[model samples]
Target chain A: MNTYDLIIVGAGPGGSVAAKIAAEKGLKTVFFERGRKPGEKNSSGCGLGPRMFRDFPEMMKKLTPEKCHSMRAGVAARNYFVNKDDIVAGYIMARPTESVSYEPAKSWITMNVYRSEFDPWIAEFATDAGAELKTSTLIIDLLKENGKVSGVIDDKGEKYKAPIVIGADGAVSTVAQKSGLRSKWSQNQVTLTLQYDFQAPSEKIDDIMGDETLAVWWGSNFPASYQVFFNDGFHQGLGNWMTWWDKTPLFYLNRVVNLKYYQRLLKILDAKPRELQAHLLPWLDYPYNTYTDGIILIGDAGGFPCPLEAEGIYPAMVTGKIAAEVAAEAVSSGDFSKESLKKFDEGWKKTSIGEEFEAGAELWNIWKALPFSPKETMSWFVPMIMEILGGIFDWSQPHGKRVRQIISHVKSYMPKATPFIMKNVFPLVAKIFEDDLDKIMDPKKIMKVLPKLLDMLPQKKKRRGSQEK
Target chain B: MKIELEGLTKRIPGTGEFISINSLKCNNCDRCLFVCVMNLWRKKEGKIYLAEDYQSKCLECAACFQVCDAGAIMFKYPAGGTGIVIEKG
Candidate 1:
């Protein structure tokens, strides 16, 4: 039997960072990796958020060479919203100087890295800082004694004891399963993601990525959006609500991959599609049970990925550090009960994880409201907007014809858009976007919205039904 | 047009069976079939059955078990250390 102060499972960012901090605090920590080496399980997401450097300055030293280069001189970026035809309907170009952060040092906002390289580097970094690292060891179960977790049992039946255990495992976490924390995540709580990695030479990669750190293509005509990020190569993928699977996720990926617009983008890059990767990400819309007596869960295991972007690294590492800090305090006080571990939850809530999760949920609520199937809002709305404006301003059409076109189209589209706008869009705007609706509300705005509101009102027949009843 | 691609290559390395559907408990609503991205579950003669020999394709996301409200789906990790190993993660 081997014992330590804390045993962390999974060598991804969360577990490795926890191991490092606990060891740095002289807690005699040990972390286990199921893979042969850290980062061997190559789950690729675009980058580290600015909060990563803010929360753990030490990670500044661990940035991959590519990340460092991107950070030193931020990459140009473009986001595109395309229709089914793959014609770009919306686009935004971003420079590093346009980053959202007020802190100049954090201005890069996010630096992309390949998880295969980054995860391994961080795990070795933790080992270098005194955390014992065990690789290729699959933890079979959490060892329990007196109704509390005391340690873990490996697949080989090897037992290692510790006062605290952190389930930093990815989405399919064994620790969460064996500890009676969760059996499975519901479809709404997780997103199924599938991506194709295109391996391109450095010069080619740079040329393809020129003036763009990330490019996104999406439209209501498609089942979901697609994103491509450039690092050592191009990683393009789609993630959609698990519940939305009319067909397998790969079916949608196939559609996107074969789309003319996507093919053109690849042609421009002249990149070779190397591998197809898939992973499940937990998108916790609300705070979840993350800690129990003598145990804590972080990262995807805790369902800590961002709801908005599905970005996991920053939140995982943030929660990992918080878990370690709380565990250290518990160890110093000689208390490792659920009461003490609850501090891990409270500590993390105080950090950006809580706020980011809230934001993700807010945005997701509106996003999920988009017509799931048999409706194409973007395809219809964009052209209609242009037509309406053209009718009013384009001047090519006669005034009477333009008025008729605008009125007829508005009348037809209003009914369909009304339900979504009133049901999903309005509540979102009222609750999340508008803090002072009274002040924001003007006579003109009300007049503008009134026709749609009137159109949404119950029809005469429906009102007659109500009267009859 | 179809885009040809390879499925997951690695295994979870387990002798223990991971997913089982209790036919007796299932209503054969086929919800599991629709939810499983791996196409592992199917309905035949109004009864749900898993595909023969496609268990290796399971991502183990448990979407089937989660969507099965009838408690017919039993999902556990393949015996510790045996199941899908994401070699490339």
Candidate 2:
């Protein structure tokens, strides 16, 4: 029989989690994966963070680094902005702070894993919970009865029927489009990254990349280039929104590793390219719509990634659990109408899903604006920022003389900084946070910022620039 | 920018033919050439084309579909379990 009480498409974290819960609730559940296995289609090889641990403690505990074939990164990250001369202009090392209340903070931040290994481990939860998993099955269309999604049709000639279907299929969600609940992601809505996974011995990686497992390099020529250190290897790539792909992401990513600034890290990785992969990532806010009739969308299909970091797995799993709850509610009541299924939307909003999606709305918009927006003055401002910041510790004279020298040095960065402040930072701050623009621009506020602005000018600048007007 | 795909592994399934180009809609800007990770899209006599052996090499990331603004490219996942087998990522 191809019928289940609930059917979930795409057995990534979302579908698997939903299937697990649906089965536990005594619903005959089945989940399908289009790839040969669950993780084969998933990409990015991203780090799974503390949110997963906190949310699903029991589920996470079983999938240790050894069990899941994952690399644990003890270090958080150190960020850098590199200049034209292949030198660091500025750096901020984010040391993990000691936590007083948050328990997860006492532990590491992220566990880097190969998606090929990670996704299957999570799928085990569903199977263990008695949820049937069908691999190598692609849902090409939805089965509708009286204009409501009743089931799904796989790429094979088989059909699966259920009262409810959860679309956990990712960014190019065929389920979402076929159900008429959503459309294709526009260029601005999505971005893709191109990466080459470089291999090395596990011990070699442990020594070469210690506390700085994540080393980010931001230059004008490339979209934020970064290296993600794994147990035996690392993934290096850069990406920008589709709207910004004038040269294609492949072009920009290839240029990133070859740059003089990245040569140092490249030498240490000293490994050959093992796998070259590109994956589409969703950068959307909490979507306006998620459920309709017998259909509910979760994960990337629902566009549930956090805007700040595009973290999808947590949202996918969280939304999947919520969707399954709603599915159980619908199955028991024998009501799968659009109105009844509306609870899926209400359920997610009341949880961290709402907070994450709503919070990152602004940051994601700013990121999208980076490449295509005409106001991008980063071309000039970054070089200037590098010179000022990169020279911050230089001291050839007495402490007093060095202090005075730094002041004069900051003067050159102002003209270029002015436009960037006005164009990008200032407006984003005013528009996103404060209700009243005038209050944010009040002279008191301006005074706090203007002293530095005034320092970028001539004569007695150091002393006069410090005092309030 | 040198692209080395010599180490790439893909399991072809039944002569995969999921991506197609609509030549009538082709503006010939040729963004497809560089965007392809596998470099499967080739240009012959100034017309962009794909080789018959593309199934063996294509990773099916559809970077070309994402970049083609002129509506000339049609892309779909090959038959289930029929495309790139990502072992590392």
Candidate 3:
């Protein structure tokens, strides 16, 4: 048995980060990668969020000009909403930096990185920190001692012993499966993604994508949303909910790539895919199991992928650090039990990673659980919501009539209009807008609109009479 | 139309066949068909099966194993360097 203070499976961001931290703490750590190289089997074109710089500044020093593309500070959040025919339905561009009410100092800056270059770099950081990395070593299962995880066994039937093991083995983690810590993710919990890496000239990518801004497209025709990030070239991909498919992702990909909108962009970049990559990543609705006795799961294996954007690099690194912090304490105390590792669970939740996942889950459920299928949700609900919000500030309509129009629209679309109106929507709206309502109710604001409101009263009464009849 | 992934080859030979579905436990919910990006799974004669020896096209994301509620899917990654590899990744 090869023994170490800690053993980590999978040399992706999670395992590498854990190894770096543990080794920094003077704990002997060994991390294993199944691929011939650290990132040989990993996904590419990840967006490392602002939290990456905040949490791991040392890792930032490791980023290279070739491996990473530092997104600009002024890059705004831009969303292009496409309809069934690939027509742009609505566009939203918000410059967080320009918002007076928003604090620019706390804004997030995203970095685009290819895992092939990024993973090997991070793994090298761990090695430089005195951690041992065994490449091309496939960890098949966890080694158990009296029903508690003691270490992991690689493909050659060789067992490596450690007081603790961290499973960072991406989505299909063998350690999580074999230890029975978690065997499989439900369809709803994970998503299937397929991405194409296009090799374009740096000048072309900059010209087409505005140098630093990232762009996202949401449409009914797309299996899921599509994203484009700039690396040396362009990384464009689509991911759909695992169980929401009417056709295979490939079918959707073919359709999306040929769309007029995509075709125009492709033309600009002279789109020729250098490679195609596919992956399964968790989109945890809420926090799921991540830690166990003598073993902790991090990154995709632990279901820490950010829910809203399905971005995994930040959560993986953040949780990796948190796990290492907890593991270092556990090793120092000579306690490798579940109770000792529970601190990772509590500690991670309090961090930005936990907050992002929790908030992302709420946003996902609101979009997913709407009383419509995925297609309808995008085609009908999203555009309608955007239009309604757009109408709120439409100066052409009287404010009073606009309010009535918004109420009518809500009632028309809701599945059970009466109960939804009476039980939830009305009370929540009233509570939220109570102060604004008092201002609007002022005789001054209403005086100008009284004639317009009174003129509409007969029509409203006639409509009510028909309903009652 | 199937998009030709030129220069695409198995990372290692004969590894894609490791994942399979057990017929006894599968209730033919067609979840596998929905989840597989390669279109490798299909329902035939009221039974579900892989449409072809198509695992080489698999991304090996384990969506099939995870999505199958019937516990009918048996998933194991192909031997190291034997399945798909994203060279640019």
Candidate 4:
């Protein structure tokens, strides 16, 4: 038996981060990777969310330009919601807003990174912290001692012993299965997405998708997809709920790439197919069975991917650190009971994971449980929004028409967006886009429509207004 | 403008064996067919089966295993260093 104080399966963000923290705490740690290198078998093109820098404040200063090239591309949160026919329905350009805490988080929505380069870069920290990394090994299952997890067994049937094991083997986690956490995620809990990596000159990517910005496409016909521009390449990824797909993702990808929107982008970049791959993500909400005796699941294995955007790296790293601290305490105390490991659960609650995942779950469910399917919501929302914006912005439309467009669609959006509307958020958005409408706010026209808008309000408010009249 | 899926979906040998359907458990709901990103699950003569070149075509994300209600599909990541290498995800 190969014995270590801690055993970690998968060299992903979660596992590697755990290894680093555990080793730094003076516990002997060994992490396994299925790839020949740290991240070759792993996926690439990830957005290390703002929380990463917030948590590891020293990480920014630690990265020497020579150490990591992928990260030097800088940070951006320029998001685009693309509609059917590849039209951009909405665009959000990120800049500093009100902030006293975590200043980098203001402009840095996410730092785009290629896992092939980024994973190895992070994993090196674990090794430098005195953790051992075994590459090209798969921990097929968890080893048990009297119904308690003792460690993991690799594919060749070699058993490694430890008092604690962190299951970071991703969404399709083997440790999760053998430990009886789950056989696999159900259709509702996980989404499978396919990505096409198109390699291009660095200049080409910067010229097109903007070196810093990443775009996501959502539509009735196309489903959910993204184009993320990195240093040497960009990834066009397509995805949907696992159970709702009536056809393969490839079926829709073929149709989408044919549209003029993508054609012009591809032709300009002169991109070539570098790799086609897919990833499974735990999406809907968080998982209940994330921790047990002598075992803790982190990352997608623990169902920690973000509900809104499906980003896993941040939650994974956060949980990984918390789990490692709990693991170290357990090993030192010789108490590997589930109660002792509850710290992993309690610790993440104090961090941004709970706030992010909880709010994100509500926002995500609004899309999933909408009056329309995810596909229909995209089609319904985008065109309506685009028409209203076009009505207001385009000079071709008469002022009356723009006002009519705004009033007509006002009924569609107000109910859906109001409850969670941040203070001034809606008004700012309305103000920014309604400049043309502000000019055309004819009082007589407002008075005519105002009565109808007041009627749409509750009868009690209308009665109060009628008394004033 | 037109992207070809044929040349894009690539794979190394041996990982296709990672996912197999258990005969007795299979109810043939064909759910796997709908969920597969690569469309590697095919129906031939009243049976749902892994396509012949599944090893080459399968991206190995295991959407099939997730959606299968009958617990018929068995999936594992292939032995270390022998499966699909995701360049960017």
TM-score of the second chain, each candidate in turn, equals 0.81, 0.85, 0.80, 0.83
Interface RMSD measured for model 3: 2.1
TM-score of each: 0.83, 0.89, 0.83, 0.86
The 10 consecutive residues of candidate 4 chain A with the worst lDDT sum are A419-428
lDDT of 4 by residue, A129-246 (tens): 9999998798888788898888888888888999888999888888888888788777788777777888788877676556465765655567666777677777777776787777
DockQ of all predictions against the true structure, Cα-based:
0.32, 0.57, 0.58, 0.71
Instruction: Supply the TM-score of chain A against the true chain A for every candidate structure.
Output: 0.84, 0.89, 0.81, 0.84
RMSD of 2: 4.0
In candidate 3 chain A, what residue range of length 10 has the lowest lDDT sum? A417-426
Per-residue lDDT of model 1, residues A1-469, tens digit only: 8989999988899998898889889998999876677765646554667677777776665565753332222355565555546565555577666446555344453566666667877787689889999887878789888877899988778999998899998887888888778876777887777777676666776665663666555554554554545444666677666667777766666666777767876777776766566667787786577887888999999998876666788888988899999989988998998888889888888888887654556566765655233144666654455445545664566655566556666666665666656555555555565454455454457657878565554233323345553
Candidate 4 residue-wise lDDT at A267: 81
Off by over 4 Å in 1: A66-74, A84-90, A96-99, A102-109, A371-469, B7-17, B55-62, B74-89
Instruction: Give the range where candidate 1 chain B is weakest over 10 consecutive residues by summed lDDT.
Output: B80-89
lDDT of 3 by residue, A1-469 (tens): 6899999988998889999999999999999987778877987436666667666776784577755452333255567777767776676765446443332224534566667677888888899999999987778778888887788887778899998988899888887888677778776777788877777776776676663456666666775554546555556677766877777777777776776777787788776767777788777866567777888889889988776666788788888889998989988998988888899899889998777654554545544543214465666655566666666787777666676676566544544433333443433344445444344354445445644554454344333346653
Cα lDDT for residue A139, candidate 3 = 80
Looking at model 3, residue A22 earns an lDDT score of 93
Which stretches of model 2 miss by more than 4 angstroms?
A: A98-101, A369-378, A397-411, A422-437, A443-453, A456-469, B1-3, B27-34, B42-48
| Candidate 3 segments exceeding 4 Å error | A67-74, A99-109, A357-361, A369-373, A382-469, B6-10, B14-17
TM-score of 4: 0.86
DockQ-superior candidate, 2 or 3: 3
For candidate 2, write residues B1-89 as lDDT tens digits.
Answer: 36577756667476357889999888987877866766788889878888778787777777678667887888778888778888888
Model 2 Cα lDDT, one tens digit per residue, A183-262: 67776677677788888777777777665677666666677776778878888876666656666566667766777656
* Pairs of colliding residues, candidate 4: A44-B89
* Cα lDDT, model 4, residue A246: 79
